[model samples]
Target: MKRLFYSSAIYTALGLLSGLFYREMSRANNFDGYSQLNVTHTHMLVLGTIMFLVFMLVEKNFSLTRHQKLFNWFFVTYHIGLLLTVAMQMTNGIMTIKGIEVSPAIAGMSGLGHIFLTVAFILFYILLNKSAFKNKK
Candidate 1:
């Protein structure tokens, strides 16, 4: 539970920082378009902050620590995915704004991040199902 709370708090701070970065970048004319940074901000808020906070609630109800390994994997993979995706978006957005071509590798990494996130969610679902069914008895 403490881990969940800490993770959620960290993500909340990151989300706020991402929003600020987006606004500052736009105001400075650093980007011709704000789409990628906008996506970063939104993703941070939704996936990083809100999702983790929701997971904290789930932890409270389900005692997710009982499945410690699965919970750790889910937490780690989700954050890694979030970080990878956001970092790629930031890099690509900044490069585009500076009249540089975005790298194919960066796009590939972003896709990989989504894959990690997908796997994490699948693990989370399994954890939830296990907890729920166990409690049904």
Candidate 2:
């Protein structure tokens, strides 16, 4: 939870910075570059920060695995998806900053990230169920 609070704080700060610099960015030679930056900001905050907080809460409230295996798997998949998503998004932002269009690689990685995120969520749900059962026993 403390980690999450810090993450949220940083995310809010980034949002503020993005907003404050918007006008300046728009008037610059790289005006079009602002769009991808905004997008990456949203992606990082929404998934990397918010979703990670939710994952932490779930893990803390429920000791879902007898061993660390399931917990580690969940964390790994979640971070992999989150990192890939953010990286592709940042790459796309860089292209935008250079006035280039988004590439197919970005599109493909985004799709894969979505799939992995879904799978991660499913794993979390399964872990929660298992934990609940264990508690009952």
Candidate 3:
């Protein structure tokens, strides 16, 4: 139940952030626009928060094989990825507002963050599927 509560909180926060970020980007009025903020935000919400919680529920209801530790690692890595991506994006937005070009460093961070998340998702899938369809009786 506690896991569900935290997961719900993450989802709610993710939705709020998505709406707010979308509004900011729409208002920016950048005509040359194909920003990854929307994509990144969606990935964070779907993979980082939603998937993590789903795994938490599976962990709660299943008999796992040392998978608990891996799930914790997934949680850490996923959040780290999200934090890096979001910080880079928010910083880029600030720079855009200040009339400064986006920094290559931030771009690199966002890219690496994406990779971390990809790996995290793979691990999450492996952990969840290992016991998701097992016979209960």
Candidate 4:
């Protein structure tokens, strides 16, 4: 529970910061159009903040400590994915705004982040299923 709360708090901070960044960057750029930075802000809020809050609530109900290792892995992997995706998105957005072309490798990094997130979600589902049925007679 502590771990969940801590993670959720960190993600909430990150999401808020990202939103501020997006707003400032857009204003600086004269609000010309959408950018990958916008995506970064939204993803951080939805996936990082909201999702982790939901996870924390679920933890309260399900007592995920029984699968400590799995929970730890899920937490680590999800954060890694979220960081990677947001970083790449910021890079891509900055480059786009500056009229620069993005390299294929950078684009590939974003895809890799998605893969990590997918794996984390799978682990989370397994954990949820196990915990949900653990005491069912």
| Model number with the top lDDT | 4
Where does candidate 3 clash, by residue pair? none
The lDDT of each candidate is: 0.84, 0.67, 0.67, 0.85
TM-score of 1: 0.91
Going through the candidates in the order shown, the clash numbers are: 0, 0, 0, 0
lDDT of 1 by residue, 41-91 (tens): 788888887888899888888877789898889889988988999999988
- Candidate 2 lDDT, 94-137, residue by residue in tens: 56766778879787997798888888888878777888677475
TM-scores of the models, in the order given: 0.91, 0.71, 0.66, 0.90
lDDT of 2 at 101: 80
Candidates, ranked, TM-score: 1, 4, 2, 3
Candidate 4 local lDDT, 1-137, one digit each (tens)? 87777877887788788888878877887767878987887788788878888998898899776899988888888888988988999999888777789898888999999899999999999899889899786
Candidate 3 all-Cα RMSD = 4.1
> Model 4's lDDT to the true fold?
0.85
Stretches of candidate 1 exceeding 4 Å from the true structure: 30-32, 135-137
